[model samples]
Target: MSTSSNRQMKLAAYVMAGPVSGHHGGWRYPSAQHDILDVRFYQNIGRLLEDGKFDMMFVPDIQALPRRLGDSLASQLTHGALGALRLDPMLVLTAIAASTQRLGVAATISTSYFAPFHIARSLATLDHLSAGRAAWNIVTSFQDAEARNFGLKEQLSRDERYDRADEFVEVACKLWDSWHDDALMWDRATPQFADPSRVAPIDHHGRWFDVEGPLNVSRPPQGRPVFVQAGASERGKDFAAKWAEVIFVTHSSLASAQAFYQDIKERARSFGRDPDQVNVLLGMVPVVGETESIAKDKQALLDDLCDPEAGLSTLSYQLDVDLSPFPQDQVLPDLEVGGVQGHYREVAELTRKQNLSLREIGKRYGVGPLRDFNGTGGEVAGRMQEWFDARACDGFMVQMPYLPGGIEDFVRLVVPELQTRKVFRADYTGTTLREHLGLDRPAH
Candidate 1:
């Protein structure tokens, strides 16, 4: 909305309240805490993010042990190579919300798996509890294991999943809208309660679901909780354009990021929505230190713990191909992979460009460094400004490589530098997540 030099970039923290964070074995770090079961551990993170003046802290949920490579789930669990244990992200987010007043609390749930009414009611209730600072990260669960758990033989095809997601969101929105803002009347003088005319049942019949709604919860303070989606595929992008207020992406290069930023905005425009309302946030993993050399050393620390076999297998799952049968040195075949087409396309291009073998790809998984920011405070801050100024992304979801240490480094070292440059806020100027992100509250 303003000149390039004057605009301030937004930042959110992406976390998973699992046993490990950052790289595969990040929980094994000397400084990393092992108390995943404790409520205090999560509250502390919420406070830290709030102190950093971060716009939001969002946690994604994985329903199952998303294992694809190496030998078994036991191997990865034994090594703590990936997220070791799972907790309900919603439960953790509520704990965070109870502790932090202003910080945005976001949690993910699968639209593909959960009933629309269930999600709509849950998020609405959370929004009320969080006092308008709640957000929902809508996901169409991709794990075959999760599908099996739901008593399905296979995951729906990508198109089918998105179609169902479209309907899922439709139903949720209707439920959220079923009760008007003034529907509740606490006029005790006349012994009156909610006005019935202000609430209507949404008789929704769709290909994916049928929900007779009037969600049990009241309308949320935010009108609807902020809708966040992280899907970079073509179908994913289009679906995001219409329903997502915040879109998360994974891109290897600035050029591709810029292309995505432009495309999503244009796609939003074509949908008769203001493009500015949609924030496209890229996932960034930064390793910051007091000095450039120190940062590189920290980067080396994670690289050593990277589990190539585990990483490659996970990649295979993302690409929807079974790489388990292939040799380490076998070249990734040019055959089309299913699941996430965007991920497949990005990796295919990388493989061709670098002529990388499966072994090389595997090692690069958590170890190789995706969006690495390795340098001193000033050096790292300058790089982030370049991306923001270049319009490559609206902002970043800082994927902290470790736990408190990863978060502390950026907040202590890099944040001040950004504030000094007038490219990031020193203090929060708003209360609700929408106001913090410069988005308007939804109108009834």
Candidate 2:
């Protein structure tokens, strides 16, 4: 492994904490968390990730159930397929904050649906409560179920949604920045707890929203907790380049990932931002064990649990198209979806490359391996080092196929191998998440 002394790879624990995280039947796996409703399980996972020297533990939330192909909620629950995705990530994240000293806990909240003020206040509160170890995963929701909940008849056009999101972010940034670092005077004699000059109103009037600030909360610890974006479409990339400090990405191959990494960094530079400041983390699944054979078997067991029916149902909502209406053997239809432009392109490209049928695509959905790995701990770590050396990504969002077991295996096995190579941290050297991720804290 080409280990650079200055450039250590960042790693994060990615979890959904719904019914199944990555695998369709992951919750059914013997070692996976069957009683996921327990609060202790969530806390343990966060603490474990901190023990492993992870940058952050992210809870990717969905405001609504994954409804597809007219699949009833009962059917989904019965099959343990996307049973429920609406748990408030903020509540869980706060609990995680209390337990772990260094682990950054993040929540996925939709920019498309939420009022900018709400996002600003809640995330700021988290940053304060966590003592700066907080992150916000910005997502433009792709679910029609989410749109319905927001009282929208249908999703906005792609251009419109991005436009609104751009302004949404603008509003949020204004709110976050409204309270200056020195705003909290805390002078008992003067009885002026805050300096009015330092705290000013950002009367922002934009295309999507109108907001008058000074936020109720003071400046967040990291000055608008580490901004994370997970969009990869052309417009999404532009948005990320402008504001995202960390980007979560999905690419089918290393070359594509590398291409994406280079492009996004270049885009950031074009926007007058330091390219190196933008960390691109690829989403990947690592099925690991002590030996290669053991690892492959572990992966196979997860793959075998693929339920095509549930997969198809899940795909419909993901692709934002009703795949249930299409014939099983028919070539996957090209739908002009208004959501998740990047994912839509990925799926569209998949069909275009191989002329895959709906059934095949559904199977592929059940098996979502974005730059997956199956090998011994050393081998898995080796692959990761190669990708890092190749400049495919700054690090990885290690997507767990099943709970606790997959995490325990990776931390126990792969982390030691990585530490031996001196490519990953053995113990946290920084207190805040930005420091751990090698990012400079935003100046006041």
lDDT of each: 0.81, 0.81
Consecutive 10-residue window with the lowest summed lDDT within model 2: 77-86
Which TM-score value belongs to model 2? 0.94
Q: Worst 10-residue stretch by lDDT in candidate 1?
A: 364-373
Off by over 4 Å in 1: none
Clashes of each: 1, 0
Model 1, 1-444: lDDT tens digits are 567776778899988787545566467667777777899988988898998899899897766675666436754566665534678988899899899999998888998888989888888888898898999998887767678778898889888889999999889999999999999999999877989999999998878788888988889999998989987678888889988889988777889889989999999999999998899888778888898888888777777767676567557656656777877787788766666666676677678778888888877665523544668989988998888888988888888878878888889999999999999988988888998888878887
- Residue 83 error, candidate 1, Å: 5.0
Q: What's the CA error at residue 387 for candidate 2, in Å? A: 1.2
RMSD of each: 1.7, 2.3
